[model samples]
Target chain A: MKAYAFLKNTPKTTTPRGKTMMLDKGLGLNETEDLLATAGDYLDYAKFGWGTAATMDRELIEKKTAMYREAGVIPYPGGTLLEVALLNGQFSEFLKETQALGFGGVEVSDGSTNISASNRKQVIQQAKDAGLFVISEVGKKDPKLDHKLSIHERLMQIQTDLRNGANYVIIEAREAGKNIGIYDADGNIIENELQELAKGGTDRLIFEAPLKSQQVALIRQFGVGINLGNIASNEVTALETLRRGLRGDTVGQL
Target chain B: MKAYAFLKNTPKTTTPRGKTMMLDKGLGLNETEDLLATAGDYLDYAKFGWGTAATMDRELIEKKTAMYREAGVIPYPGGTLLEVALLNGQFSEFLKETQALGFGGVEVSDGSTNISASNRKQVIQQAKDAGLFVISEVGKKDPKLDHKLSIHERLMQIQTDLRNGANYVIIEAREAGKNIGIYDADGNIIENELQELAKGGTDRLIFEAPLKSQQVALIRQFGVGINLGNIASNEVTALETLRRGLRGDTVGQL
Candidate 1:
């Protein structure tokens, strides 16, 4: 039970209504242990954010993945890692090594690199065959390239990924959550674009809401059941409070 | 030893030249434990940001304070917390509670409230008398109020705080570090104002550099020995990387 359980004006008292995917950019083992002790129960998946996994020692990454697994949270490297691996034509080695390191999931994204539709499907299937949960991402890292992808195209990719045995599809907003995907330059959601994106049900869709405003906005739009991704590890409890209406933002509103 | 010690080509290999004061904006005990374990050696102080310390259970705050103390990091509430305590005429009680909780330091400031200069001096003296390291901050939380204060006024305040027994003075940028204090709207440093502020010397001043660019710029200007405050806990290692030239921004430049 929470310390101030009696004073908590929470809507979702026992369980969170939506899934929260936390981003672990480069957390150390002890730091990950602390995160698990504090906010582990509230998190569903942990993504070692973009290319950062490659920067740490392989043993360190292995320890972190084990910690996350023990906490019952799926751990996966950022899609950029797979993109880099694919770039080097070492996709098989990358998949084997990631599993060896104890990761439970794999993210296939073309955020920084280009991949043909067939190869994307093949990679998703390959990851599933390698005994990992597959999450495919939609959108590019570069704003210019992202803007060129129409709402219909993004929607199609989401549908295709879901059909290709991906457990979930992520709408990529990168870490900044601005000027890419469904958000504007000021980090505000593009209403019509989001409406189109939501055409494919929000169940398998995880909107990368790194910013608090984005989290609040998405929660308000889709109710408390909306899946939010790219959440900073430190903000997990704060975000959970927002979802349960224990925080000021959604207190009386929810 | 650093995990990727082999790949790290860092300058200032032996020691970090400056002090780093991290902002703990409502971290629980477990989170504090993780923070200390991950980046304790790199940290000089841990600040419970704003009025967050007053919001948590007294026992929880005590535990966090003890944790920080054990790690050799001085723990103090944010200046606004003192401002709030002073507002309610509970300054003495606040100081006693903070001491009993095992906080090694106290931050005296009028970031959110107005305190007469004489009273400010008295409070600094009062805190020092209680055997707490006093670090006073100079900057209004309100951007407009902060902008109205001239560079000369800020310098005078810093000198006053130092003379009143403050161990060090902080140039307030708040958490945002933009459009207030010595930073421009785009978070760029106002070089002339910063140079003027440094007239009193940089050794006794801590710049609230929450932004990476601000950290890099300050390090470039003052070398690696410039004191920085309001560093996010997770970014402690990342900031250390920047300080030692392990990060791209300061790698070759430092």
Candidate 2:
């Protein structure tokens, strides 16, 4: 059903297509329906993005979640909301509210707050036990704090999150995709860091690639099957084009 | 009817609220409606960026333009598309096609092509004669070429375009809003250049400010009555909040 179906390039490898996690900063119901109509099949998860869900009415959030669910895309609140709830000693309430809001998943991240390793593990298990898909993020929102954590530490956290029952582990690049996790200050990927992180295989890893350059680099490096996250809602179709080698960046190269 | 109307700040000056021109690269019908529903009152123009209008079906573009017009916002094709049409010697056809497509306006820009000042004046006049709203842009798309244009030259061009019947003259910053016109490489405004440009008065100028920082700074400097263009579709409501002192950036200051 693609517009230019005849121009789609065959995959260079037999690797299956990867999951795409879109960042929904704030979208109305009509906008959500529009997204699904155009690029629903290409998306796997929709993250409400860093406390943005809290800014809207609960009914609107529920409607958005239901829409995503109807389209088979798991909808989840941002990890920062969970962190805020945890700070207020309302983690259990947050989980309950997340379910009531029709969210099918929960992102457990310590990006903005300090959570002990044991607590982080428990948080992942709790969300999983609550019949929600758990995606744990590894890295800090603060650049200075992020720099303090070595590659070895990030890899170990990824391992721990997977063992603790997270469905996928996401590298933290935030929305801007610059100077965080595997990306440099200019938003370019650090090849050595990316290589080290991919040592444990990439099937369960979602690299938060918001920029087109990052998406192209990651797709080229890990084949089209590399899970990518933090994509802008409008760029969903464009990303699918890159994945399918329909875009100039990956045309004939994939 | 604003969500948090009680918390709105009073304007510091009696200047009327400025116009906002959102950049619609390629939005579907549902997305367009959602935009109108949430931020219709805040918008004055909707630009189908670059030649993206050429990429989609004619019907879809017509539907989008109709929707925008119904919401009281003028819909126009990007200036680059006009430049493309001029290169193909399809200027008249382009104007005819634009009207058939339901676009209320046309942008005449030399951002991506070279058109002599006289020809540029003709282009503007032709669009005006066609009963279309004309918005002329002043700046080259290539950063190097943009940098070569002196502020005095830019001012002269603005004067010429206004004289030629342009309803408004946009100081081009392109979509990225970086290293062009009055903005520096980091997307920061060169205060002196902006000051120089504003000497001819800013009432007829539309500054293409895509970044939030730029929007905040301009609102701060120009008392929320500075016409801004090239805003991202999703940021329309957020920009309105900034303009009305609802956002933190201009809350107390405005």
Candidate 3:
């Protein structure tokens, strides 16, 4: 039971809450266990942030992934690690290592690198074949390259990835959540861009709303069930509060 | 031993690293232990931010504080909680409760409320009298009110707090660190304001720098030993890297 439960008697909801993908950036064994113990119920997926998994001990990553799996959250290596593997022509080794390390999922993103369209589909299919949950990301790491992609092009990629068996196509906001994908430079949602992207529907799309305002905006826009990704580990509990209208921002509004 | 120790063979520094004060906004017992285990050596103070202490179970807070103390870091409730206590005429009770909860320090400030200079000094002396390490803050929480404070006035307050038995005085930048105290709207440090405030010297002052840019700028300006506060809990390791020139931003510079 939550402390101060009497203050707000939130009605039980039949509608399921949106999936929350938390960004795990270099958390030690103790930190990972603590996160699982505290806010594990609130998270659905945990992404070991860009190239961070490669920096730690194989044993540590395995233990962390086991902890997350035990908590009912899917654990995945960041796409940048995969991108790095592809660049080195070691994608097969990367997949074997990911499985050996006990990761339940993998993120396929060309954020920092490039892959031909045909290759992107093959990669997604390969991950799926390995019995791993595949989440393909759309958008570039660099804002300059990201801006060059038209709305039509983005929609086409989203459609292609979904058809290619990507579980969820993430609209990349790159942690900072600014000047990338559907967000403007100030980190605010460009409504038209967001709407255009959502035309294909939001169920299979996870918006990387790392900032609080973006989380609130997306939650408000899509009701309580909008998938949000790249959330800081500390903000997990707070995000759950926002979704349930326990926070002031969505208290009466939600 | 650190991972990737061979990439950068950092020289042993006889110079003491800066005192880092981390902000704790409602971390659980497990999470607290994780923080201590992962980055406790990098932190000198763990501030339970802004009335968050009041929101948790007494047992939980006690355990958290004990963990911090065992880790050799001073744990304190945020000044806003003390301010709230002062508002409620519960200073003595607050002090008793703080000690009972095992907090090693207390922050004295009128950020969200008003306290006369004499009363503020009395509060600091009272906490010191109770055998608590006292850190007095020197600015308002509101940006407008904070801006109204002249650099001279801030210096006077710092001197007064130090004289009144404050072990350290913090220049308030709040959590956001933008448009408050010496920072401009863009969160960039205003050189003139900072220089004026540091006229008497900076050995005894803790600047609340939450942003990476602010941390880098302050470290660059004042060397590695300048005291900084209000750092997000997760960034403790990252900040230590910056201080030691392990990160790209300060690799060669530091």
Winner by DockQ: 3
Task: Calculate each model's fnat, 2 decimals.
Answer: 0.07, 0.09, 0.12
The lDDT values for all models are 0.85, 0.87, 0.86
Off by over 4 Å in 3: A1-21, A25-45, A50-62, A69-172, A186-254, B1-17, B50-58, B81-97, B112-130, B163-165, B175-179, B184-191, B198-201, B210-226, B233-254
List of chain A TM-scores, every candidate: 0.96, 0.97, 0.96
lDDT of 1 at B174: 84
Across B1-254, the per-residue lDDT of candidate 2 in tens digits comes to: 22212221336235578989999989888788777766677789999999999999998988998899998999999998999999999999999999999999999999988999889989898889999999999999999999999998999999999998999999999899999999999999999999999998899999999998899889999888899999999888667656655443454466
**What tens-digit string does per-residue lDDT give for candidate 3 at B1-254?**
43222232232254688799999998987677667656776789999999999988999999898899998999999999999999999999999999999999999998999999889989998999999999999899999998898998898899999999999999999999999999999999999999998889899999999998899899988889899999998888667766765443454465
CAPRI tier of model 1: incorrect
- The digit string of per-residue lDDT tens for model 1 on B77-154 reads 888888888999999998998898788888998888899999999999999999999999999989999999999899
Where does candidate 1 chain B have its weakest 10-residue lDDT segment? B1-10
In terms of lDDT, the poorest run of 10 residues in model 3 chain B is: B3-12
Can you write out model 1's per-residue Cα lDDT over A76-151, one digit (the tens) per residue?
9878767766766778878887887788999999887789999999999999998899999999877898999999
Task: Give me the chain B TM-score of candidate 1.
Answer: 0.95
